[model samples]
Target: MMNRLKAALAASAVMLAPVFAAPALAETELIFNSYLPPHDELYQIAIRDFAAAIEKESAGGIKVTIPDTSLAPSDRQYEMVRDGIADMAIVSTGGVPQLVTLNKIGDLPFNSPSARAASIALWETYNTYFLPFDEFKGVKVLSTNVLPGRQILSVGKLQAKTVADLKGAKLWSPPGALSEAVKKLGAVPVNSEFTDLQEYVTKGTVDAMVMAPNSAKGARVLEYVTGMTQIPGGLGSLSFAVFISQERWDALSPEEQQAIQRAADGLPARTGAAADEVLAKLAPEMAKVPTENLEGAQLDEFTTLLQARIDEWKERAAKKGLSDPDEVLTFYRDVLAREAKASGS
Candidate 1:
């Protein structure tokens, strides 16, 4: 009887041992910071999809979450993420030129008829030329993109049908090539960030601005801009990049890294399309905005002025060790041409 009882106890112990020894797998959490307003549905979708892909690729070993609001101001996001205040971020390269001028290839006023084409072309350029650079040493870049090529916009009706009309005009200008373009065109540029422009627009303090139409729409300031000049090759474009802290990215398992990269592959085109969709949706309304159609000599002169900016960028690129900036610029434009045709842009 005692032997039988002991045997039964031993059998129960053996049956429970496996269950007691097994442990639940821990999930690695990544926090994503969204500095821009949540108006960009496509970008938001890409981020969400990227999160899902990461989870799927890692087989649920990793999880990501985006809070309802930003973790920091738009200007400070690069620093925030670099410092590991947040694990991931998508920030405009223009805001952190000191940290990432190479990615500014997207900002070079290198215009495209389609933002999608521009974005993809720039992404490819980044991988080919800028990816190996040490500027992003503390960050792991996921993707780079250009906003919809910026068009010249003004509040109220204007006869800005010619570059001469812009002479002596005070304009809100983003820092960098756009600001330089405005200056070269004889406009007084009030250098400022996007956040500062709304206040000026609301008060009619500035005469005009060069910005992506979708950005104006996203910020709900479209109603304020009543004049426009559409440029297929924008005078300037905003560049942006998405990234994770190098420490955090390195901490991820090798499999997780591969999975995350695979997921990141979709961001550039998605962000570009989001800008286009917003612009397209507001097209009818924008059409109502009085436009200055620069023609003949005016068009040539305006383009000539913008062309100088390209030379400036090439000089800067050479300084950055591109060896031959013209070759790289040509490659970028060629890619844009091919991609534009493929996407029917």
Candidate 2:
């Protein structure tokens, strides 16, 4: 009888031991939604690296998952995050102008010397001044980045030799500062989503487009592209942001928040570096494509037009109640200079 009782007790202990040894579930699972395809360079740099960093920093307490397909369209990203459809998303500031007005300071033509400088400057400025704006009220901004300026990608034999050449040209334009600048440059701005650029160019709906190299390559626009005008300082660099839902952010403990921030701290620079590397690799592929480098008198003319647009931007910002737009611009330029000098760009 004693042996049977001991056997029954041993069996009960074994069953309970299995349950007790099980690992604890993660406290949070963040779902990151991205519009870029899985294999795109930006996806690898911004989405993959960010997710990995967060997972590692959380030490199994938080997990991040990116869906195989984008949860929402590019323009709807901000709304998706704010509405809790996605925990986090990568969104372009130009794509959502109404919600990201102040952040467009980086989008001014010839604003920063390089992607690295622009990205760092944008991130720092956002933390300093743009945080108080109502535009960012419903989301927790993680980091900001900029592309390596916009170059003119023209289909067929068209070439923009000078500012006068741009007159009457039909150009596909992204919204915000770039669109405004394109109009001022005497090009007829044909507004469209970046994703639809190839169709528009192929159909001859537009004669040229101002876009980042990596983005143009990814969109496969190069297949129809016959010539490229590499403008110095470019038309402008598009600014991007990684953000999380305010509701989701509030749910995290202070330690968790810090852990996430630690992962995000250097993301802009990392992304900019990654983009530069990818562009370098893609350069050879574009070797046979006819290209012109804007310089000398033509380049100076473009730069002058850009300055006038900058003044206009300042006026708009001031009208929106941002005090000392000049100071803000000066601060951004200073940051860019410092970053450029430090990076030897």
Candidate 3:
């Protein structure tokens, strides 16, 4: 009887051992600081895609949350993320040139027309010309993409046909060349974010601004902007970058890293598609905003004047010890052209 009892107890111990030895996986939660307002389609898309990818890759061991409010301006996003106020973020380097000037190539009037072309050319520029990890110290760069081509929106009916049309007009501008461009065009440049741009326009704080359709719509500037002049092929598309803290990034396992990269790998295409959707959806509403797609003689005239402004930028970059300003400009042009050809744009 004793031997039978011992045998049964031994079998029970063996059965329980496997369950006791199983390890519990560690779970991590990360956050994404968006430069977009809450629930904007692009913002939502990024959040959903990133969360899904991370969760799927981690097998419920990791999670990501994207908050809606742009708590910081576009310029401050990099610092905010690096400081670990947020684990990851999307930021505009051009908006904060003092922190990273090499990315300012996006600010030049390189005249990229389509988002697809712009995104491809931009990634190429970053890979070929820009310094990698050092360029964004303390942060792990994930992806960079371009906004759709920007258009000049004014508060009044007076079309900006020539440089002189901007005489003494007050315009809201982002930092760097875009601001300088405003000054060169004889408009006063007031630094403002999209959240405040419409208020400024409504209050007559500034007379006009240059922005993409999605931004113009997101900011509800359609209600305030008197007109939009499409400046395709005369100005470069704007760029935004996604980054994560190196500390948190390094902690992620190989599978998690690949999942994050995969999300970034498809970002340019995803963003471009989202931009197209926003443009299509916003067009009819923009019609009420009194937009004119400038082309032909008007466009030609504007292009000539804008081209002349490039010399000033070159001179400025030279003053700042940017070796080979023309070379930089040429490289951008060549890459942009190549991307256009490849994309059939």
Tell me the lDDT of model 1 at 70: 86
Q: Write the per-residue lDDT of candidate 3 for residues 1-345, one digit (tens) a residue.
A: 999999999999999998989866447788887777555655655556656776776676777777767657766887787777889887776755666666556656644566656665666666765654266788876766676776678876657765677788877777666777666666788986557777787787877776776777677776677777667653445677777998889988887788777667766657656666777787777777655666788667666766666776677557656678778777767877886787676
| Per-candidate TM-score against the hidden true structure | 0.87, 0.90, 0.79
Q: Sorted on lDDT, highest at the top, how do the candidates line up?
A: 2, 1, 3
On lDDT, the leading prediction is 2
Candidate 3 achieves a global lDDT of 0.70
Worst 10 residues of 2 by lDDT: 128-137
Which residue pairs collide in model 3, if any?
Answer: none
Predict model 2's lDDT versus the native: 0.83
lDDT of each: 0.78, 0.83, 0.70
RMSD of each: 4.0, 2.3, 4.6
- Model 2 lDDT, residue 196, Cα: 82
From the highest TM-score down, the ranking of the candidates is 2, 1, 3
Model 2 Cα lDDT, one tens digit per residue, 248-317:
9999999889889989979988887777777778788789888888888878888888788788878877
Report clash pairs, candidate 1.
Answer: none
**Candidate 3 ranges beyond 4 A from true positions:** 1-26, 67-74, 234-237, 286-301, 308-331, 338-345
Q: How far in Å is the alpha carbon of 134 misplaced in model 1?
A: 2.6
Question: Which candidate do you rate higher for TM-score, 1 or 2?
Answer: 2
